[model samples]
Target chain A: MKPSQRLLVLLFSGTAALRGGGFFDTLDDKTRFDSDALGLHADLSFMTDATLYVPELPAQGLLTSDDHVFFVPRLMTFFDAQMGDRLTLHTQMRADRGFDPGAVPDGDVRLDEYYLQGRILRDDDLNVRVGKFGTAFGSWAKRSLSWNNPFVTAPMAYEDVLTVSDRKLAPSGVKFAQRRDLPDNKTNWLPILWGPAYTTGLSVSDRIDWVEYAFEVKNASISSSPEVWDAAQVGFPTNPTFTGRVGLRPAPEWSLGTSVSHGTYLQDSTASLLPVGSSVNDFTQTTWGIDAGYEHGRWQIWSELIGTRFEVPWVGALEAVSGFVEAKYKITADLWTAFRWNQAAFGDVPGLDISWDRNGWRSDIAFGWRVSENIQTKLQYSLGDKSGREPEGNHLGALQLIMKF
Target chain B: MKPLPTLLLVFAGVHALIADGTIEGKLSVESMKPSPSRPGYLPSPTKQPVLKPESAPAIVYLERDDGVYPRTKTNETVRIRQSGYQFRPSMVAIQTGTKVDFPNLDEEFHNVFSCSKAKHFDLGRFRKEEASPEVLFNKPGVVKIYCEIHQHMRCFVVVLDTPWFVKTDAEGKFSLNNIPPGDYSLKIFQPSERLIQQRVTVTDGQTNTVNLTR
Candidate 1:
């Protein structure tokens, strides 16, 4: 066959293979049940962010325009029969078209998350999962598609601490889980136990699985080299990382969650000024946060209070606290409007009293319209206030179209 | 001409023996604030314009020809219309062995199913104007009705043991006649609302009233 023909055949085969796993038709229950018993899903998103750099931090990458798009199509399957009568086999495969290094020159796509899982024992009291699995930390981590999240990107605090460089869909492990109902019906009581549910932080969810307290933990080691950076200026080193989360679901429509992590970051070495050579341990970061949400009727309200504690060689201990509130109202059957406010304060050190505290306040408003059952359009505007600088803001509007069969 | 006087007397006697009992009632929101269980406070059934004070209620009529015991029931054509991909009456109460005919009056097709423990069956796809599918409800309980096509479409099928039941009108009133002057329980079912049950004694021409709010 000709080269063109061979390429066409390969493309068709890949599409068929992904489609056959049943990931594309999970939204509709009848379609999922009537056509096949398997579950399939696919999500794609594109976003452009513009930031303004203040004179104080003008040297760093600030006030820059960055546009990123990612296409992550995933396939999952479930066997009709259980593996061990108590265990059932479940697996997933993902192919990405646009997950690349953040500093890449232009549009870049790289390999993303992939893994498998199996239910060890599914009973009224105990349910165990073993194998390579995605992180299961918070509500947002499990449902990470930009199309699903209210914001285009993750929270800045999470991005700063967690290692998101490589598209780790399923952290490459073993996990066990147990859920028991308490005695009283008048009081809502449910105790749960969970862990490695079979995987580590290959995916964002794996890092936050609810093993012990509606939360999960991810531990891994990564090493990378980029051609855009100077080799002599910064030494490349492998660093081990850890991330974990815990959540509480007291009611059907209410949830509270918290996450914490401490890890090392490979960065440039500045030893000339130090008395000892290589005395500086590249970089280390620690972050922790808590959030809660309540949804009732046509209204949804959520608040997240988060903080980050960082200690670099020369930078010493830097601490930051952020609090944000968001509200969503459903105007019509398929239309909704949301408003969010965020305030963050940074401290130079843990206990020192300082004259100036780096701070930023942001307000965002968004209107979303479901044009059709499968397509949606959203328009959003954001304004930010930064300390020691003028108020800066940007407006972004997007029309997103999605279809599955 | 001579038989005219006798016929007029007979008609007057028969009219005196017949008793017409009327039933009426209203459905309203307890408050503007959305309840945790029921968020969308639908309009009060009493506020509907078509259901005026005089024509206050929507009634289903059934008559006993002999006006006595050993009742022989007749199947009443109760239409559960499907419009805008939703069931018109979110809640419905029927007697045991009563056959319910689900008719799709919408332009699009629908898939109706009941996952309730009492009855579990999926009535496959049915198109517009097609003959409705009928199911004989033999159990007494609340059976949840859902449309597979629309995730939000939901309704209830309340099956009861007794066939003697009435739905209130726009005026919030209901009357059950020919009750045989016995004591029984009155069960009311409504969508996204609470379940109401009351005990009452019925005499030949006595009238009872109940007002409910959720």
Candidate 2:
């Protein structure tokens, strides 16, 4: 960011500096119930966040001019039901960012997850989940909800624009790399790891002593968005993405985990764009990450480091590293503050100084207040700096109010 | 519903006939804090409770070293009622050996229990508007009460060794009449406040008007 923007952000987020934590309660008795004799229980919770933001419109990047000084109101609903002690069902529905065309207030609603889980062991030492589920590649997916996550926006690895595309292969490596500078590359440019990355899949996870592990076979890669998560819209487990994770909790307050995923990064639509003899499977994206967290009392510390390598038809390969370290503390029973330092750095081509994507660093700070037992309000500010770019515009100020019942 | 003080006055019939003194006082609590045993919540229950701070009552009693102090009648019974989502007065003071009746007034099931060190007991679940099995108070200390299903609902049972205890009204007024002439120790108990103790001399047929604020 430029000097003026830096000063603006510092002045904007200075009051939220004493980073802290709280796990908010966003569910009520009316929305949750238990039947002991029937061995049944269910809960339905809704979270709505209204964000007023100042978007730095990159010339040829993800944010458009329409994003400047606008309010993006979004709502998400979660449903969970359990039968007996071993079988459970879960689902998530969302309506956000104006899913409708022309940025209309009439947003389209989408179902993000509908899955069933069964604990094979009486002690839950062995468990299996089938149907649509979030990719088991990282821990970020676990805390993506408004009540669990301290920040409004996701980490850079999960939301920042990447030079790689799943819908269309870059015409040329040089041109692919150039698009990150000053061009309109909307949905065509994908994030290294999409938000939640809820893909159609089946996974088997188990907990043994202090260690937990899981493996998943999904229809699409981590970069695939909501539009291609279903089997009909994408591949049906034919050489699908493979994800696995292993976590260890040696103590009640600290957790350490690592994950790996390898998958074909191209869609069927790209079949027509490949060379005469090349197949969609020729290109792939592989990612591995490590996550760590320490939560004791009112202080919580979280960190994740991800390394990804994508092979393109023209560009032999592009590698990048993205991650973040965040901390939050509960200043009081009703108030909390948090701060995150995140960045995405791409490796330079073999001989050229240009990387596959623009390297950027960003800092997000937020303060949250509990308005009541069922409501919370968060004020957040983000400062971003893009390397080798013009019209440096990546500063945003947002206020989000969430009411759950 | 200042139930205990009214009951204490009636129960004082045996001691009022003798040469006695009276103690009346005004009490005000600066804050009504959460129960110490309240389980830690994710977003801890923000702010002080909304249990109407102005209605927080004080229980004041006198403990005397005089050997002739009257003993409470064995099996003396007292009734504390439950209505809506709360205990009728939310608190009460009673002498040891008193038999307490906890009757559910709401047309719903309610479980009365206390994990207090003074007296640990669970009255079990009662049917709609059913009378609870009598719980005899044989110990002298504060017993915090709760319902199994409704975590927010709470009540306190202050068991006293002396029968000269009375609770304050909404205006922080309380009167302890018909006390035996003697040197006594004044003790006060508030569920949300610290225990307060003071020394006093009760002269025959005299009224001691004392006031306290914290």
Candidate 2 lDDT score at position A278: 85
Clashes of 2: 8
User: Candidate 1, what DockQ?
Assistant: 0.02
- Candidate 2 lands at a TM-score of 0.63
My TM-score estimates for the predictions, one after another, are: 0.44, 0.63
Instruction: Report how far off residue A138 is in candidate 1 (Å).
Output: 4.7
Best by DockQ: 2
iRMSD of all candidate structures = 24.9, 17.7
Model 1 CAPRI quality: incorrect
lDDT of 2 by residue, B53-93 (tens): 12447787888776344675445677766665466767788
Tell me the alpha-carbon RMSD of every candidate. Answer: 21.1, 14.3
